[model samples]
Target chain A: MNPNPPLPPDQPRFLRLFLASEREVRRTVLAMVPSLADAEDIVQQTAAALWEKFAEYDEARPFTPWACRFAQHHTRRWLERRAIWQRLLEHGLAEELTQRREALRPEMERRLAALEKCVEKLPEEQRRLVTGYYYDRTGIGALAEAQGRSVEAVYKMMQRIRQALLECVRAATAQEVEA
Target chain B: MCAGCDRAGGGGVNFPSPEFDGAVAAVCDGSVLERQAEELNALLRTDAAARDEYLWRVELHARLACDADAILGRDATAVSEPAPVAQISWRRAALALAACLAVLLGGVWLWPRAASQEDIVELVRATGSVSWSSEDGRVRPALEAGARLSEGSLTVEGAASSAVVKFRDGSELTLSGDAELSFSDHGKKRLTLRRGAFSADVCPQPTGHPMVIRTPAAEAEVLGTKFSISAVAEQSTLSVETGRVRLRRLADGATVEVASAQSAVATLDATVKMEASSRGVAAARWREDFRTKPSELWQGSWLPAEGAEPARMATVPHVAATRKDGTKVITQAVSRKDSSAGRIVSLMPDSVLTMKFRMQRSKPVTVLLSRHESSGAFAGNYELVVPPSTGQTDASGWRTVSVPVSSFIAKMRGYQQPPSGGQVSLVYIVCYDAKAGMEIAGVAIESAHAGTSTNP
Candidate 1:
């Protein structure tokens, strides 16, 4: 690493902890907000907030859970300002979501592991679609336009692929459980 | 196939969930209908099982969609994609073929800094006046060819100017026409191009940290790709010539993965949604009826085609113009330069530019075309000045003007020649005065012989 210059002494520590916990913390925010875009924004804001408050953090305890707490706070604050999120949050779903998402983390991780194989198993056409839309980050509209399909048609195909992958992962998990 | 997903089946209650699955998929796809959002929220709000499924699906989406490399591996993701930067020669390459600086310099650089300064990048080539400075506003040193630079900012000034740099990793970044790039290969390759255009043929980066290019409106995360970026204050546009790039708009945190030959725009203020990113407009196809989707190529004051026929109309924008005295001028005309994140089509010699609009008073409308060498350097500018109409107009009061490419007089200073063969990059329509009440309803750059309707 080229000493990137500007830093406090503990900057490396903050970077190490943040990089490790980023994926989990991102999942937490994704659970809060429906938008991957907004989740990314909240997670970025949470990272900034965490770095500022790093001195206050009890380093002995796990940083993942601490970063997650900040992520949840930013997600809620982000949601609070938007009228679209107002009705969604009226039932006070954040706390329940945080609690429930933690409960599902283990199985979800297993399913995520299974997804790699399942994705590889997809037909080349389907795999390219996944790579283009999911990996390449092509928008649904752009994907539709490129593939010469209607936007609705593309969404339906994506739904089918996700659903198929879900089934494939579940089967793989079941085989593991049985074994 | 399993009947239903059961890992999402904890709390032991599995409500038949095909409909729920569809809703969650829509959420992940960003195509969730308003009704679906409400329904999906209601299910999550009321039931724990639904929330379990939601978390499960979203996590899967997050890993597969956002964390693609970690899940699929780099080898699987990077291959078989568009790679437009395939032809770069390692020792030196022209920036957009716009720079013949390497041939001009003979030596790679004008001068190298003191040996003590860490040489991280090589200015392999440059054209016109290129400036260099440290990240902060100070340290103004004029940079020349083959100069090894410590991590800092570089700006290629003038429409005709360009520069290409080779990084420590052999990655090549090209800056064209009034663009500034502040770059560092420190921990990972990161470039901040706040304004103007930057193109690159990136070398594959480390597994986790991809190269990042930040503009005012968005940032592009590149994992070894051939791409070009153009940005103004309000928007940053990314066009991927090869491979793919993920462009995230800072305004909405929205990101789109642009693939080869495709472009995506992230805007900070414009209300006009981008129509098409794929740009291969035919000579006859180059038209603006002000209907349906608005092209990213246009910016102007538009109005509904009133009186004649009530049909579909796109957007209405106000186009202000410069008066002869240079006062009473809005001077801001709809331009190809500002929104030129699209097709780089060269104008055939006989190309005719036309416009349909209504003016409150008779005023001369000026059409200006900014041309560049086929190599992408600004050659000169030409203008066609149409005198105020003394012709009949339809009941709607819209007058049509069509001027062939040959009619445009050489109006450029410093360089004077007709723009007969140069690639036409900038096209705009201006009027003598904004108060002349000109509202442009349509415009087109067409081959001279292409049929055009004359509004009676």
Candidate 2:
């Protein structure tokens, strides 16, 4: 078995502790809460309360399991207050999946920033096409007419643009992880 | 029916319309297979494998779209509302189209449109200076040197390198040095600071008439009274000398009011912090001191000759007249015995003071100067007596007597000392009972002066 390593005690590092075990703790809290919204609220509250109680925690042990136990405690307390929200807690998969989604937020935001930069560097005409479709709610058919091209041709262009952007975001995120 | 699909199958779905395709692209995140299925459903109809592949492609697309939205939205929202920018671009396009159409349709006449008052006002600056000239000879406002303004269309040239502009309400705005200013607005009251530092003591016009100062960074609105605003490329500061000013971030629409003697700063996406400015309430004594410098009944043209020697003309033939209503309304043309003999004593009050000119007799007549109660003394106790002409042919004009209350009461005996510091309390002219039918023709009392004298 891997020996429990000690966290640095010299400086306040509760933030690091919270970040490291957020996923498991969030999942456990979500399982006991009804609705993704309620689960998210409960997990946030539990994290804050747990951080305040960090002085009571043993630093040498695994952080994730310990935080999960605290999260479960708070989730049970939250469920006790409202009967209707407790009913949503019966659907175990929904709550569990939502926690996974919440855990992926940091990764998603990072990827999103990367994809945005690549899209902006596109040629003005292409940028317009993308903006017209995404922001203006303009259809490819209207874009086709404006460009004096067939609808099918516009569709093909959009498909290529989408593929290019996806590739760009993926590459950027991969580079970030490596760095 | 939750059909789990992938990216490859998206191409096969025969979408009802292209708008549906764009909507799919906007809402769906490409990494989510569930969203990918939704996108493929909008685009095509296909087998489960194809649908799954298509879902993958859409998931990728959705992710890409999110990225694009974030990057662009961040940069764009950091600027002003996109609607106007978009409209500006659209206007440029429309102008180009109009130009082309004008050429095709021959002989199109475009009327000359005069720029708006907002355009004219925008030339005013919070700081710095500018010079303006107008061949039309209309007095216009200028900007201070090195000050900046916003985009505006109206341009007015200064009469000189620098000159003072007197607003309609007799307030002065000084624009020093060579300054150029332009003001523009879209039929709304908006100001664009074009150039130079120009200071104006603008009387608060009606509401909705906003005084806006535009700098490179943001716009400052003078909601009320006095303020001085200055702007550079990266920062804009509005300091209120008096009253209040609201500094608005034109880009982000954030606003903060700078109260009396306080300054607010606007830069980039940062919050504004108001600081106390060392420059306190600007010198406004000039405005208060500048009374419409009183002129003669005739404009201000009449003046005493430089070296004229004064000679005494005492008791020159005098006359007084009773009005049709038995009120002694005296005029120089009516029943005047002498015009030059009346000792013209000027009464001017330095501050607020009330005084009464009395002509005592057993009975009194209405004292009228210029056919009106120059003072309302007649309606009260004293009988404003109109003295009849003893001999002369002209209207009953009496020799004007100079009697300051201090000197006149000193000669007579009991009068109370004026209360606050030596502020003169009252002025009384006693026509020693010999002039029974005597009329107090003209009496003038205003902001008081130092010494007493008679007009010979």
Candidate 3:
């Protein structure tokens, strides 16, 4: 018996499309919702809503765009409930900001592409801290307490590290553009 | 600071400012104060440059959170526990209690079980392997029937394990399979289903405070209702039998009102989907007499009620396989072709299963009730255990047992749920032991909700 049985025709198509485009969809939500946690929430909701509404998708169009559109819609809905985000959506700045981000998409992607290499060049300890803080979703306060450092000092250090990574990504991207 | 506006400041979301960088960084790391959050929100709404900078930081954050495990050669941050707790002492206690339960005195050894003042809840009954422990890591003294505790964790180990807990207010929670639940009822009733499948009958609470149940993926603020929730690390599913429950996805803070007969799933990825569950099995009653041979049987012969034997189906198990120590013998019978081909036999919640049988085996006997939906969808498989304590008093060794079908729990976890007015496609009598001897007089099912019993 073949242990790896083929998925039902409907499921495989959706899963393949979704998996191929998930990172792009998360990136789309990240443009407007800058907080990783909140953007992640919107992206997850968008994924479910997309799956539920997958049958209605226009196959002629690209999958990532459709997925991003769903992500944007969910992000807008999510934003409309909160205080500042609600204001942004209501005042139409959220749309304008989206347009601005869309125009900057190429630059952003280039920078994102260069990020791994830049991260690889960081000191081993700094790399661990970056990965620990960002990837592990560890609370800053908890991290600080565990490391026997003040939360403020940790945040300041994190800010400096982020600035360094940003500079490195920009430099790498600029070099790529020159090349 | 993911998204908020409950602080001070309106619109100073300036780019390249020290305060802006500080605020954004603080928010990203979840250490933002109220004032900083309000200021950040203002900046995000008004200034495009500020939004751009913030997005870059957030994009970085998002990438790291998503691929941290990959970057570190490990999995991403775990879906944090509902609340951190669980000890292996529970497994030890469970094993020890299981050993104690195996011992029989003249058949049934009745242990003294009574509720004490410290007990806000009592363990009404426990089947299969179960263990209990407190929040601070103290094992329960005994796994008695009426095991009571003010607050502690009760875990049912193995797929076959299940335990019923009843509160002082008559609210009940049933935990099944390899699941753990930590509970306390001080000022407000609180239960954290760390991991497991749990069903609850919650009573009306005090005005402001509702019964709060926290799982990894979902949180339920239940006022009063009958609901079942299955909690796993990545997802928590809720099925409401009656009344209503407010279920919140902890990941996204999205809330949904799950009404009666409705079901919902809160996933770790923060998706909440609500839909109507199965219509459930239509109510019905059934009975079977060993007038003829069963639909399926192995290593068995039918005895036509000769002498004092009554109409019986006798099975003497023969070795089917050999293990290192000895031979493994198994006997199973699915009662006659009454539910053959297209016919559907519905068994409701209040259905009473009455069986007359005699068994000669070291292990306890199991009655399996397998079911399917009217649409031919696989529903679930349920079982009722006849423990060794139900001794054979008479010389003939025959015993009559009638138990509520509601007592028949699911045979496997994370599968279809237990019988709730569902179609009975198969009923099996099984004995697992070498040289096992089993004799079945008859079997009958009487569902009060549907109608009276019938002679077949």
Candidate 4:
């Protein structure tokens, strides 16, 4: 037997398109569910649903919107089953957000690309702070404790970093347009 | 004080309110209080700008959260602890007094304690003939999976052997067979890949200290990425799977930026050869939304070879007036007589070209992949032909085409096959036999394979 069997041609094509839109689906799910673990779970479920119903999908249209709809469906079902958060968006609001996301997808992608450049341009200390807070999932209180700083000070620093990042992204985006 | 709130109080400033930031941060971290939650909801309901900012922050946060490892050059599981600043060796008297004070004060004391080695990274997993040598030159012949490794050198001795070293900051380095690497965290995260091949899945390094992987002929300044570096005698090759790597040839101090799906080879006394690489899978695929002007994304020059008219191409607001959706497409019209009238783009290796196009006239479309050889001659030219039936001409709807890199390699022309490991510098979509008017949208070069390791 072949150690690495080739995937069915149709399967690779469908998977390529699916993977291309995977980030958008995950981002949508994350916006609904703040918890990374929960969002990941929903994304996994969405992927399964997408694969199961991929044959039914019309190839004429873009893949993102379709994938996002499946993601939203899974997200809503996950939220309902867990009753995780009371402040979760209603179906109508969720649908509205999805449509808005679809319209702004291109711009959002541009911003994301700009963000990578912006992040590289950030000051070393600020980058570490971001890595700790966001990537490491270290709580603000824990970070404060580790740094021997007040929670408010850390929060203020985080706000400053976010502000700086936003400005940098905007500046980078402008430069990209200019170039 | 909330800066946005203060600015808002002053008069007209479009800054996000401090309350908004705090609420967003709290919500993102899953630590929102009831009052803060209520305020956040109310703000989202009332303020459209706030909603937009919320979405932006959410997207940014998600992106960062997902890419923290590549950005930080640390392992996801490595929860970094505060480094102990001072160490003091004391006698029994100090220890007794500290214990008594701790008991009296309910386990809280302000006394200076001895510094501990809590921040040291360990060899969490090792397999198949892996050994380590300590800073003191203590040689350990074989290490178990959970062996503790401080600042030291590790060697993977045999074929089919590998070892994984986990750093305190959550970064991981996987050394392939016959590889030797020394790591030190004296100041910044540093690793010297002395010989053989190794893949690093780095977490975001601290701002001042980028992870530097030094080989004999070159050094790669890693700013958080999943990359593989192989060093053998005279040459060192760096292949970037995700993020960016700045490779500097040690012989002449020449540097080049290698982005995702790109690679560079550094050799002694030679200009480093920057090539496209398709190794260890693609972490993120490429997609071109025609939202931006064509010139911004692709080479704008249209090459009209013999018997071909100048191809008319423009970024139109919509492909057709029939579809009212606010989207854009690159519309190209080429004469039937033209053999080489199309756009050219620099593409990475192992890319599958996918495009949605609506052709006005049914004709066979040829997509050509080309590259220049070391001798400054155009060596590799590969073509994939889409039959007229497949390259649909119906204006009512667009047809999609997916062409894999394997197909291009299999169909390459000339004595020399296209280099399987480097970048393809030029791509041409030509309609030679018919007057082709095509509206192209969703042109993308997706990765052939998903990355091997999952993001932690």
Candidate 5:
């Protein structure tokens, strides 16, 4: 079976995951901090904190749900610092979080667009290799054996391919402004 | 492995399969992947340099991915701290006292202690620039006119004049004209250039308390590295020369970690946008503001005008003709005093003493062109309070402000009376603030015939 199946036009799994996680993080943080601004600050802090502590994460598990748990912890800490009345005010705050989640979707889409432009500029074979690894989760060993090359050679080639793609994006964007 | 390749040969070779693995290892280690990978990549129709460069980036990506995995592994369960000993227990109280003493001592050794109030210095200038000359005669412009310089902190009126500051740690910063900048000399340094263009090459301290450059539009902090920043009037731009700089805009408050050769521009009214450059292109420059050569100052020395009396109390120093942006510098030693102010006095007849230099600051500066009265005591008169708003931060290109000696020191006895009879000893271009000191970085005095005569 082909591992890299295209998503349907109606399917918004990527968008859904991005927005849902962003919204949940915001909502969970707001539960602790009564102020919308303060909640946003905590959410951002939590995201950065998550990134900084990324080594603790397990790639096998889902990232969004795990990130939401971190958001909840930070939110609880924020709420604990506030007055009792603030706690009562935020009881139904999560219900209003959908708007913020939807608002962030466009920004994510734009970044994805930039990423697409960057990836397209990669050499054709490199592009295929990246797509296979990221999208199809193909093992380096399997790829190497299939091509009758060692795993080291395959991994090294993959590394160069990724670097080339990154450079292509940088040059494209830099020239865009210079032009 | 081929016999030639096994000897760690130079470029130009077709390597066997085993030698290719060695070359791949070399690329992974960031050395030039000598012959094998280059040859194989050629066969694979891949760009050799691109492949080598990508190896480093992919390693970083894998590291980041690994870090993500580690963060996810933290036990979500809360770990409680040990209970504090009750005051009722005498042994616990003694142990707590020892711990407190140890902590205090350790902190004193680890962190620099705050200097006593007497050790604190307050140097202020309203409309002057300050520069430091090294033993080798290399003069560094530390602050520009219409700016204030104090103990480890420099603030300029964003609209008046921009300042290019170099910290002791080799961090170079150019504050956009008219921005307020404050720097703490602590190991974990802090810089707050409230509004204006600012760029720095920050060296991080342990505990990684970022060296912060705060502005109206954004805040850029670094752990340890080189970078440049231009805090435009309403927008701030950050470009990393080496290492990573974290930029956080105050609006949506998005934070981005900018790697080397990458730049981000954030404005008060716009969303933050970032762009990256090729590594070689970005690493070449680390400073945000550029200055003309230091030797430019020594190139044109003042020569007494023909038929003019050797520089006397009444005669203004003569300088070679200069453009509107050109600066004429006069050097003098200043004595440290318990209570003192900077004054420019002593003039010669037909003297056209002009205070012309670049200005960058946001607040109004009380520029005093003062000379001592007959009593030989410092006096404040002939003050030109240039408004805070009148300079460019970016085109900052160059503009000159010329105040005639007659107009500048008119209120003084020499300018008020005949230039021959009145004696002017001390002159001052002092900021009115008793604390926020000003820096007179560069100054020039044009001969009376500055406009007409080419020879000094």
Candidate 6:
């Protein structure tokens, strides 16, 4: 074996780490911006900002938390520029939430894994509703009109489904901890 | 008992208050109101339990938003059920011959026999400026509602204009303004939607004659269903309201079967991707008729808030009735001294609040619904000031109003205090307006359902 193995290029390695942490970065941005469309815009901005400053990233440090800092910065700027009605979190509150999220990252990962299993256990109709609302990005008004139900009824169904998912996740995570 | 005692003494140590759970649940679904938001924010800032629940909900909401496809088991390479191939191919051949004969006969010979073929469609409703062009490329103003067009292009211009076409086979197509589409009966029953949005309620076609709607980027083949197709320059989206649709991307010939309440998208350079239909829930019907006295059904007393008027029950004949029930009504006469308000306790969380009432005078009338805990403490609520032009009253002047339980949840979320539990103990309906007489006959809370009512 060679005593001095060549190290990976900084740019390519940084890109790998950046891409690997994309889910966490997106979650960080979404925590600040409740709207998925706005969060996606902020995520794009964060990616660009992180790429520009990739030289400053220390390889010894963890990449996900570093990437999340850039995401939080962009999220704050987006919140400042957004309309009052659209602003979900204040700057100070957003900062605190980010810190709390960072501390709970491992636990969140566990819960998310549990959530996947729980989501599969949902009733077919409820699963479709969740997928349509979150994945398909169908507007609530349009969905209500299509389903011939009131927007309120659709929202209620979603709430119940979410409640079930939360309970399922809690139970699953608890079982994992015990195991 | 004091509020603090109610919180600490009601439950054992380490157990979370029911109110906290309700508040957090509302937050996860984004249904909290502003006032409640402030309270929950303060609690989240100081209370550890509140913060923990808030964090959990926030993470749950974020994960669902960002990774829904993964969670919902949507994989690009996943195969759908195979479509019936032999039947489709044979039907196409039969329809192609009929289309060829219809084209050869010209407009005059086929106009009278169009009804028998089940291929002709008529413009039954036109709003604003709609125009159409025949096979010769001559543009003509779509003047009336009953214009029959066999095989040509129809265009609806202007932002406010729209046209509804009823096919001879009992299907309906509603085209929004700035939309252009060409229909042909020659081959398979096909309509080329060039641009803009249109919703189609297609009747089942004779096998082999699937209705094919083509956009710039994709083709949607339907046997029978209600669906909407929207096309822009870069992308085309198909949302199926009911039944099923097969969408094929022109670029790669990749196909996906979109079921009822599912959607699919095709881009100019990308394969079609199937997704959950962005549409809302199925139709729901929940009604409560107060044929029995309100006091017998509801546990809580109707107590007016500070400076609010008390509600009284009176007998009225022939005021508008949504259900064909009796004539006893709940009447509230608003004055400068009081706002009319009443509260009912122990309601199912999934229940919807529906009321039948008529405004004696056309003044600004406001309706507020507030949710409370079992101990009569505030939780969250929604407030709506009735608009002047609702205009849904029948000839006798009675109108029905239905409010979904989720509306209150949404309002609570707006306030930053989402409810967590599956049960609500108190509901308060408040009316704000001086000297506005409001007559309410039926007030009931009923569970929600899916699917539309034929009578509604």
Per residue, candidate 4 scores C-alpha lDDT tens digits across B352-449 of 77766555677766665544322112234466788866744344466788876557652311224434433343444555433466545555555645
Task: Kindly report the TM-score of the first chain in candidate 3.
Answer: 0.83
- Please list the residue runs of candidate 5 whose C-alpha ends up more than 4 Å from where it truly belongs after superposition: A1-179, B1-153, B156-178, B185-187, B270-456
Ranking by DockQ: 1, 6, 4, 3, 2, 5
Deviation of model 5 at B397, angstroms = 25
Better of 2 and 5 by lDDT: 5
DockQ of each: 0.12, 0.03, 0.09, 0.09, 0.02, 0.09
Q: Per-residue lDDT tens digits of candidate 1, residues A10-120?
A: 666776787677767777777767555446556556666676688899988999999988988888887775433554445767677767777777778776788888988
Worst 10 residues of 4 chain B by lDDT: B334-343
- Measured on C-alpha atoms, candidate 1 has an lDDT of 0.62
Candidate 1 regions off by >4 Å? A1-6, B1-19, B82-456
A76-126: candidate 5 lDDT, tens digit per residue: 555454332122224343233323334544543333234555654556555
Best by DockQ: 1
For model 3, the stretches where C-alpha displacement exceeds 4 angstroms are A1-9, A87-90, A174-179, B1-14, B30-51, B66-456
Candidate 1 chain B: worst 10 consecutive residues by lDDT?
Answer: B90-99
> Which parts of model 2 have CA positions greater than 4 angstroms off?
A1-179, B1-173, B177-180, B185-188, B269-456
List candidate 6 stretches off by more than 4 Å. Answer: A1-15, A55-62, A82-92, A176-179, B1-33, B74-456
lDDT (Cα, tens digit) per residue for candidate 4, span A15-132:
5676567666777888777655456556656665675576789989999999888887877776564321444354344555556666776887887777666776777667767867
In the range A77-168, model 6's lDDT, one tens digit per residue, is 76564332122344355567767877887888877788887877877767767766776566554455556565557766776777788899
Q: What tens digits encode model 1's per-residue C-alpha lDDT throughout B397-455? A: 87777777777875423334555664565566665464666666667777654443221
Q: Per-prediction fnat values?
A: 0.27, 0.06, 0.21, 0.21, 0.01, 0.23
In candidate 5, the second chain superimposes onto the true chain B with a TM-score of 0.30
